[model samples]
Target: MSEKIYVPISPPTLLESDPRANLSDVERALYEEVLKHFSDSEYQIPGIEEKGRLTEAEKFWLSYECLLRYLRAVKWKSAAAAITRLESTLKWRREYGIEDIVSASHVEPEAVTGKQVLFGYDTRGRPALYLFPSRQNTDEPTRQIQMTVWMLERTIDLMGPGIETLALLINYGDKAGNPSLGVARTVLNILQDHYPERLGAALILNVPFLLNAFYKLINPFIDPVSREKMKFNPEPVKDGLFTGDMLMSEWWGGDQNFEYIHEKYWPALVGSCEARRASWLEKWRALGGKVGLKEWEYKDIDTPQVVDTKAADAKAVVDSEKISDVLTTESRVPTLAAA
Candidate 1:
């Protein structure tokens, strides 16, 4: 008898009526406190106002949502702690030329390896990012880090209304070669320090003993909150917080075979990224370079209640192509999530 195949199901729309509707009381308080702190002249970043790059008002509006992210990362523990974290990230971004990283003309060569892909959104509407460690191509640490950052920015652009976090799925199957431990540490630091409170869940699937041992070695370095969000090799359908149908057959232990073709996948994926970049540029121009002002004002214009139909249509096409490619190859592409 043939094995049973699970079909993915769409989850109900979970977008909040008000973006702040989901914030806890403590979170709301911290949000206001952090906003006020930044708005105060004494606490302003030195040289920001002197340089006239941004007025005090623009700076406060721009840093609004980002401050909340840091606050939530620390569980609203301390305003000082959140500001410290945010300031560090801001400095890093300035030095790293983050704006250039996001607007680069071409995707990095390392990114085309199909190692990491933004598959789809999870049931909770958070973007789902998949990492196939086996597909890692470059030994250059800088390239690895850059590729990670680029993909992260891409994933952030996919965030919709009421979606502030992302689901991470790391597949450690058919081991290629050992990944650089130092590189891994740097990547983790970036996530924990700069992108705090952005992880919804991290699922590690098909872990080999050696990798599991490495995970144990590094477990101590991970924060308690992040460590708690990790789940390993559980029944995806029952315990993984994702339906089997939403995942690839190989990783989810389902029956729908799929395979990933880099050539076919890259064009569609890159096109989607380009479209989003264009839309973002248009909005930035319209806002006169004040990107996060509305969001900071606790206004609805910052977050759209409905996902962009054009973007959604493009994603659906990519999904259809992915399914078709898998069916043609008689193997599934190791998907990490379903919409």
Candidate 2:
């Protein structure tokens, strides 16, 4: 049969009248602490237009704290198991596209821009990664770039520092066209700055137009001092053309000359990604390091009441509204009584 999937979430929402009623005293303390942290400064989220707001990094960290506790307590093991499964599904999708991939699994399919959206459990069995088939307009670089940043932050929250070696499978298709150099630079900057060790491993298929654009855009941005070592130079490259082609040329009617650089080339391109992440981290630190993000880190924040399984179905169930009120309450954290 198919593997069982579980989505991780914090305590259910409570009504305004019964917010603290459902939470244990200790749990309430934790929540307060986390909320207080967010009241500080944050960067502007790309898609979110609110000015003078907490940065996405800060929000992500807070969410991560809650997510870590929830996943560690119940779903960590299963989430790890799902990674292997994700690889398998991704491989199958690469071979046959979305229709065949979805048919092979138990996930329900949704349509986004006339393409299939395959939702599945991530390393933590949470509603983690949402895979989408290539589509027009929607999957363009603008959207993809935004999504990439958002996902990276979430990845850091879920897996923590070690997730630096994570690999992503990008479906390049004939649909939305290629992303621009600005997008690539933005993505690279985020990785190099925040998640220093995390290097992205991507498979660009279908749309070759982006290859030249990305190359040109990135070539000049290479660190001047490290230009010779860090730069990627191709032979007589052109804009909007996919020249190097997919690494798996055999599958696409080539003489297999495009083997993985790490696998077959002298550079050793194909292997565990841990080293790449490490290299990125080292280089990023060498480049003067990142600024402080005080708003993002959850220090001494109030914890939420973890509604365990038994409590989920208790006789006197609390309403979601009440839970929401507690979550939204701006009241100063009242001191705990001496016990």
Best by lDDT: 1
Candidate 2 C-alpha error for residue 240, in Å: 31
- TM-score on alpha carbons, each prediction: 0.71, 0.30
lDDT of candidate 1 over 12-31, digit per residue (tens): 23342334436777777777
Q: After superposition, how far is residue 55 of candidate 2 from its true place, in Å?
A: 12
Off by over 4 Å in 2: 1-133, 136-145, 160-162, 207-213, 220-339
Residues 46-85, candidate 2: write the lDDT tens digits: 3333443433322333243332332222234443332233
Clashes in candidate 1: how many? 8
The best candidate in terms of TM-score: 1
**Steric overlap count per candidate:** 8, 33
Worst 10 residues of 2 by lDDT: 330-339
* Lowest lDDT block of 10, candidate 1: 321-330
